[model samples]
Target: MNNHKKEKGDVMVEKGKLVKISYDGYVNEKLFDTTNEELAKKEGIYNPRMIYGPVTIVVGEEMLLPGLDEALLEMEVGEERELVLPPEKAFGKRDPSKVRVVPIKEFQKFNIRPVVGMPVNIDGNVGKVVSINSGRVLVDFNHEFAGKEVKYRLKLEEVVEEPEEIVKELVKMYIPSINTDDLKIKMTKKTVTINLPEVCSFMNNIQTIKMAIANEVIKRLGVDKVSFVETFEKKKEDN
Candidate 1:
């Protein structure tokens, strides 16, 4: 895992390839994010809303942080590497201009009481309140990790090439609750037809999700169209 040596006949990662990766990201030697569930729990960063596992990313697509995304191009399947990224590659340097003072009445207008260390959204920009005094609230709009170096231990798990599996992975990425086995994927020429599971029919934001899935498939896989078929069955009641 320490030495990244690719032998002959190894499948090298390339742009536009769908690859799965597991990584642990650290800032100031403290684990900030990880793909391992147990490690996340151990580090007290486990979130119930997060799905802990290897995530698929399209190479060179900027889906990942810039540093990590560039590193993947030089790796092969099963290769592991540890790299430290500068602030620019991580979250970018902190900007003093991003810090602004707003009148406390702005918060009161929205029924909000501004408090130190509280996050707030103003004019669609997310910022954290650093201080509140004299009827003025200081908000810093820089990212929480701005101006910090980050370290990552990365492992490229698999490079997915099959069209069917690629579509399935994309679907799962958007609708994590949908079982891939329950999805019937049919590819005809340039179109990919997915018969969604029964559970998906009632899921919220399904239409939006379908549109997103279709856009990804077309953008990444060059598919002409994606069709989703949802079917409902009638139950027969007997006396």
Candidate 2:
């Protein structure tokens, strides 16, 4: 088989192909820098560490770090590339004002211990504690990786073209539940719909999660629209 043919879903391992990759990442540049290569090496990222996994991304999918995805589009099977992404292309710069002091009692409601220099998740927001005073605690909500340029050294390992494979990727990316038999998938030319079972109660706020998941899948699958439906009991119907 000619590996370069441009067929609809022909699996161009070149780009827009669903592939599994192993990659190592490093962060360096003017915006962000480690103490040194020695320190980075000690942190297990200076040397190429394996990060193998499957990803269903179209050649131009914005699903990946923009720069890394662009670089991968120019690669072939088993090809490797080292991509340097700027702050804007990476996680973006840190805002100093994101660090603020809040009453220690606010965190106590979540049963979290407010300690100086400890990391905590506040209402789904991850922040690190900078200081703890008598009643107030300083927390920085900026991402730890913010204000950093990142380098991704990646190699495409395999490309798969089967519809089932595509479906599996879609399921994994969205539901992430290993027991996929409970989830239902339906697709049309312009839109794909995912149906969740009643047993998945954690999906009560599925609308928000669904939109986020659909956004990622649509970008990779090259679909224009997607929607999700949950199979939960309706309060009105119950009455």
Candidate 3:
């Protein structure tokens, strides 16, 4: 009975595991972020320029909010959870000290007419204008999400087990344009080798991508080696 692929109950999310998940994050019943393309489009916040896909999160890596990252340690593949995270664990309570008053002339000097709720960057810190009076503007520099509870709807798609699968997942994530299934793969006890797609030969950062993918596989899957093979075609004249 313990022979087939891991039973649903047998697999539990744990630290250092490579897992893929899709999530929709909300604050105050408004959709602020999501990995679902259809939902993004329906909410009128869709951006065609960005890549949309399941996110690969290394559990316990602090790659997510403190509370959400902790929640991943208790999730199982195929489990969809709706969770609410408090302010301290989410983004921390808002800070009034971060609120500043700036003269309206300052914005006008930069060709900007400051308006309520308008975002502006000052000294590399982004803030939003909350009020305007006479010749002054009130800007709140705290995180837009601070002092609020954040709700997340998350689903773990898969808990990658084998080293080769980890490599494939990494390639799929880092090189979204490549079709990992069609790429040749050969796996040994301690190494996973993959043939690069023909189109990737001209990729600006192919080597970087390879190194990053290999490093992630080693770090997450504990594989010894990952070799990316790049083959060349013989010219007709030589043949």
Candidate 4:
């Protein structure tokens, strides 16, 4: 695609393109989530841990909900739309079977004191405790917003085109602490090589991050392989 010559707002977004967008998600007209910091604050749902701003997503990669992914492909850069998604496309209908009663002994075994509305993980599945009565704990395993219709107001900010920019965006998404400008990325016809910073060598999850980065780049960029090179230099003694 000769994306360079196309002016901003004229390019059509397609599958595998990197897209940056700002969105406000609501359920029953009540804001549930938003990329705008001010709106989140105004709605009294501000989360300090969340990095609020326009988010970048790889289109059609299931990075977003199924409904949103479908909507993204039809949008042009700078276009804005509001969409209402049914339960199936949003979070799926809630299942009655997902609500189960567990014996109080199970919680006791884990040294947990079950309380109403407490979130707990059981056998690797996350659930919320609904009620605790007479030696039994009721847990609901459904997603918090399951069975609810959702609304999203989305603005397509930009569609990223260049392979180098794509790699940088991926790296930034994975390693938020690292500066993309400091990264050394080399791309060939069928491969991408990334020289990681020295700090990455000390992170316990660096291997997993490298694997995720490699997987995305190869899958979305159609590269045969992605390699990460980590180098640690020795410091000389003070003269």
lDDT of each: 0.90, 0.65, 0.83, 0.88
lDDT for 220 in candidate 3 is: 69
- Number of the top candidate by TM-score? 1
Give the alpha carbon lDDT tens digit for every residue of 1-239 in model 4: 11233466664677877889889999989999999999999999999988888778888988898999888887777778888999999989999999999999999998989999999999998999999889989999999989999999988889877899889888878886677778999999999999988898888888898999989898778999999888888998999
**Candidate 3: count of backbone clashes, pairs at least 3 residues apart or interchain:** 0
Candidate 1 — which pairs collide?
none
**Order of models, best lDDT first:** 1, 4, 3, 2
Candidate 2 lDDT over 1-239, as tens digits, reads 11243446532346556765545567653223232355456664453442224444555657766776776665566766766778777777899998988888898887778878799877788899999888889999998878887886667666656544565565565555435566678877777777767655565565666667677667656788776676776656655
Any residue pairs clashing in model 2, and if so which? 16-58, 16-59
Best by lDDT, which number?
Answer: 1
How high is the lDDT of residue 115 in model 4? 91
**lDDT of candidate model 3 versus the reference:** 0.83
Clashes of each: 0, 2, 0, 0
- 134-182 per-residue lDDT for model 3 (tens digits): 8989999999999999999978888887666777777887887776686
Q: What ranges in model 1 sit over 4 Å off?
A: 5-10, 219-223, 233-239
